[model samples]
Structure formats: structure tokens, C-alpha cells
Target: RDLNALGGLAKLMPFTAIFTLIAALSIAGTPPFNGFMSKWMIYQSTFLSGNGLLVFFGVMALFISAATLASFIKFYTTAFGGEPTKLTQNVKEVSSSMLIAKGFLASLCLLLGLIPALILPLLLSPGKALANVDLSGLITT
Candidate 1:
């Protein structure tokens, strides 16, 4: 369906709207999503670094994060609010394969957030080998 021509999110496509909402929440760094965990780690590391400039930038990041959430909320509400437009009146849900693909990605986001340790080691391996450093020793877990 041509979502660009749709008047409201409800009118566009249900499944697509739901998925978009989830993705938007993730991007906004809401809790229980991968984005939140990653952002939290970034802020934590920046604070622990003991660098004044980094701390300032971290604070700026927080502000930007808030702005991002607000902007996305506005966008979502505006796009999904109101009634259907002429072009979107006959819009239908996306195909099953597409939904399955999106679902997999969304679930992956949640899984990574819930158990980052599962993939952290693999992610660090390349960097560890390149630097000839045992980065695993730095992380207690």
C-alpha cells in the first residue's frame, strides 16, 4: 500500500502501523527494547570515563534523546491519527513473509536488549584480536 498517501495510521494498515510503532519506540530508546540497553551502556561508559568533555557530550546526548522521542511521538500521532484518505481506503496488510521478517528483527532487538552477553563476546572478538588485547578481562561478566 501507498502509505504516503494515507491520512491516518489506523487507516493505512494495521500490522504495518503496529510494527512501525514498535520500531519507533525502539529508536526512541524506550525500556525493554535493544536501543534502551545500548543507550544506557553508552551513557554509563561515558560517565565512568572521567572525562569532562565526554560527560558534557553525554548530557547533550541525553537531551538529544529526549528530543528524538518527542519528535517521533509527534510524527507517529500525526501519521496515525484522524480518518483514512481516498488513496488508503483500500489498503491491505503486507504479505506474510514480510511480516515474518519484520517480526524476526523485532524479536532480535528484544533478545539482544534482554541478554546482551550472548552476543557481546562475539562482537568484541574481532576488536580484541586486532588490538592484541584481552578485552574480556575488562568486563566482569
Candidate 2:
């Protein structure tokens, strides 16, 4: 979905802000976003697995973050920002309605990011039914 919005694969470029956001969130162990908490569990599970090579996996996760940032910078500078050209001159700012929609979604993203507690309970209902574990009590929020 984000790929489609950013542009197709042919012209597609990475966005570091998005990747950094994912990495930071993943490392934080917060809930409701399905990022931080899951990665924390995975890190714990890997350590418990008793596989010494799991260290490499953890290292790779960090390395991938650097790569993600580099890719995002390349894409942002090359694809999005530049002096206007003929093809791009035709492009206009997205409509106010579209901006409003994006702004609402962005706020939702931030809200989920800042307060996972609100989302954790709502998600736990269905998640427990499927996973058969009481995750509701696990989240701080």
C-alpha cells in the first residue's frame, strides 16, 4: 500500500523516515503497533533458543537499519526533492481533502505509537482468542 502511494517499483524509492520509524519502533518493545513488542519477544526467544548464531541475527537487524536509512536518503533526495522538471511541473500539491486524510492517518499512527495501551487491550480480545494467551494483562498501558 505504501509502495503504491510512493510510486511503482520502476520509479520506486525507499523512504528512511519510514524505515527509521519502523526500526526505532521495533527496538522499543511497545505494543499495539505489533513492532516493538514482537521484536523484543523475538530477541528473547532467540537468546533462549541457545543458538550462538542468534547473535548474528541480532547484529544483522542493526545493520539492516543502517541500510534502510541509506536507502531512504537516496530515495528521498533523488526521487522526491529536486528542481521542477517538465514532468514534475505538471504535479500540483495534493488536494486539501487528501492532505486532511493523510494528516488524520499520520496522527493515528503517532497516537498508536505514543500510547500502545489504548490499542493493546482492543487487540488482545481477538489476539487471545486466537493465540490462547492472556496478553491483556501484559501490556503496561
Q: In model 2, what is the error at residue 131, expressed in angstroms? A: 3.8
lDDT of each: 0.76, 0.52
Q: Candidate 2 clashing pairs?
A: 16-72, 29-36
Model 2: which ten-residue window has the lowest total lDDT?
Answer: 7-16
Give the poorly placed runs of model 1, Cα more than 4 Å off: 1-5, 130-141
23-132: candidate 1 lDDT, tens digit per residue: 88889888777788767766876776799999988888888889989988877776676787776567777899998888888887778877878877886799789997
Task: Compose the digit string of candidate 2's lDDT tens values, residues 28-58.
Answer: 4434444554454456545556677987787
Q: What local lDDT does model 2 show for residue 39?
A: 51
**Backbone clashes per model, in order?**
1, 2
Error of 2 at 50 (Å): 6.8
